[model samples]
Target chain A: QQPVQSPQAVILREGEDAVINCSSSKALYSVHWYRQKHGEAPVFLMILLKGGEQKGHEKISASFNEKKQQSSLYLTASQLSYSGTYFCGTGFKAAGNKLTFGGGTRVLVKP
Target chain B: EAGVAQSPRYKIIEKRQSVAFWCNPISGHATLYWYQQILGQGPKLLIQFQNNGVVDDSQLPKDRFSAERLKGVDSTLKIQPAKLEDSAVYLCASSLVFQGLNEKLFFGSGTQLSVL
Candidate 1:
């Protein structure tokens, strides 16, 4: 099943901070995040694995709560380049790494 | 490393027509995925392949959609008798391995399909 994302849309000024949350009903083994601009492909952002292993862009950070089956992406001091749609893909062990994505959170960062 | 490649950046067809899109994954990548993204939603996984073999295709609309990755290199997704609701972006992504879901994926620009 697809995960759920909070805040369908958010507008922020440069240097602002925001948080996007993704929650899944089933237990997840990992969570992947991606950012996509208009007319472009979704770029890999970060991946949060069970047992606290995280990897991705150096500037971006995220947290995964294994017990809750939730993950959150933190955009701190947001840059104009951060303007895009963010998606979280949840991977379930039962599905053997198959990822189901959330509805996406749109972020608009203004100068 | 080169990124995943997809063909026909944009395609338009009438309802009930047929359309096909192609994808070339990065060199040596064994895992390939096809996703469908509606305008305001996230990309949904339609199928997944590991070295030319299907790993998952539970979400694919088998009645009208089909895909194949020949020789573990390139793949093609075909839609026969398309429906108006099939208008969306078809994204192709690849990962270096299929061991775990934590692997990062590189995506192609995607083929935008507009079914009238």
Candidate 2:
């Protein structure tokens, strides 16, 4: 099943912070985060596996809560380059390598 | 290393027509995936191929869409008798392995299809 993403869209100014949430109805083995600019391919940001793992890149961080079947992405000191659509792909252990993605959250960062 | 390559960046066809998109994955990648992204949405996996065999295609609309990754390097997705709803961007992605742990997917620019 497709996961649900919150805050369908967000507008932020430079140096602001924002959080995007992804929740799945089924148990997730891992949650992968990606960012896609307009007319471009999705770029991998980070992956949070089960066992309450947390991962970060620069000012962007993500946390996965296995018990809650949800993942949250944190973007701090947002920049104009951060403007794009954020997607979270959820994987289930029983589903092997198949991953389902959420609806995505569009972020627009302005000066 | 070269990224995934997809052909015909944009395509426009009338409803009931057939269209096909091609993709070449990064060298040595064993897994290839085809996804559909409608406007204002995330990429939805349509099918996945492990080597030359299909590992998952549960979400593919078999009646209208079919894909094959012959020889495990190049893949093609075809949509026949397309409907207006089929108008979306078809994206091709590849990964070194299919494992969920620490796996990152490399994607192509995707082919935007507009069914009129």
Candidate 3:
């Protein structure tokens, strides 16, 4: 099943912060975060496993909570380059490599 | 290293027509996947292949959709008798492993199909 994403769209000025959430009904093994710019392929940002360890790339970070079956991506001091659609792909035991993605959360960072 | 390669960035076809999309994954990548992304939505896995063998195709529409990866390198996805709903972006991605904390997907720009 596809995960649910909160705040379908968000607008922010440069230097602001934002949080995007991804919630799944099934227990997850891992959560992968990706960002896709207009007319481009989705690019990997970071991944968080069930153990609760958080990973960060530049000013972006993510956390996975196995107990809650949810993950959250955080953007600090957003830059214009951060404007894109952010998607979270979840992996479960039964799904194997078939990662089901959530409806993306569109983030628009203004100058 | 090249990320991934896809052919015919854009296509327009009528319903009941047949279309095929090609993909070339990164060299030495062991896993390859095809995802369909509709407008205003996330990418959905259509099929996956590991070294020329299918790993998962549970969501694939077997009646009219088919894919193959020969020699564990390049792959192709074909759709016959296309429907209006089939108009979407076909994305190709590859990874080193199926499971792991560090597993990352490298994607191609994808082919946009418009079925009339």
lDDT of 3 by residue, B1-116 (tens): 77899998999999999999999999889899999999999999899898899988988999999999999999999999899999999999999865443588999999999999
- lDDT tens string, model 2, A6-89? 999999999999999999999888899999999999999998888855899889999988778899999999999999999999
Q: Model 2: per-residue lDDT, tens digit, B1-116?
A: 79999999999999999999999999999999999999998899899999989988989999999999888899999999899999999999999987565698999999999999
Q: Which residues of candidate 3, in runs, are more than 4 Å off?
A: B99-102
**Chain A TM-score compared with the true chain A, each model in order:** 0.94, 0.96, 0.96
Error of 2 at B67 (Å): 1.2
Candidate 1 C-alpha lDDT tens digits along A1-111: 899999999999999999999999988788999999999999989888889765546556899988888998989889999999999999988887788899999999999
Report the lDDT of model 3 for residue B97. Answer: 66
The local lDDT score (0 to 100) that residue A89 gets in candidate 2 is 93
Docking class of 3: medium
Residues B47-103 of candidate 1: C-alpha lDDT, one tens digit per residue? 999999999998999999999999999999999999999999999999999938878
TM-scores, in order shown?
0.96, 0.97, 0.97
Model 1, position B8, has a per-residue lDDT of 94
The DockQ score of candidate 3 comes to: 0.69
Superposed Cα deviation of residue A43, candidate 3 (Å): 0.1
Docking class for model 2 is: medium
lDDT comparison, 2 vs 3, better candidate? 2
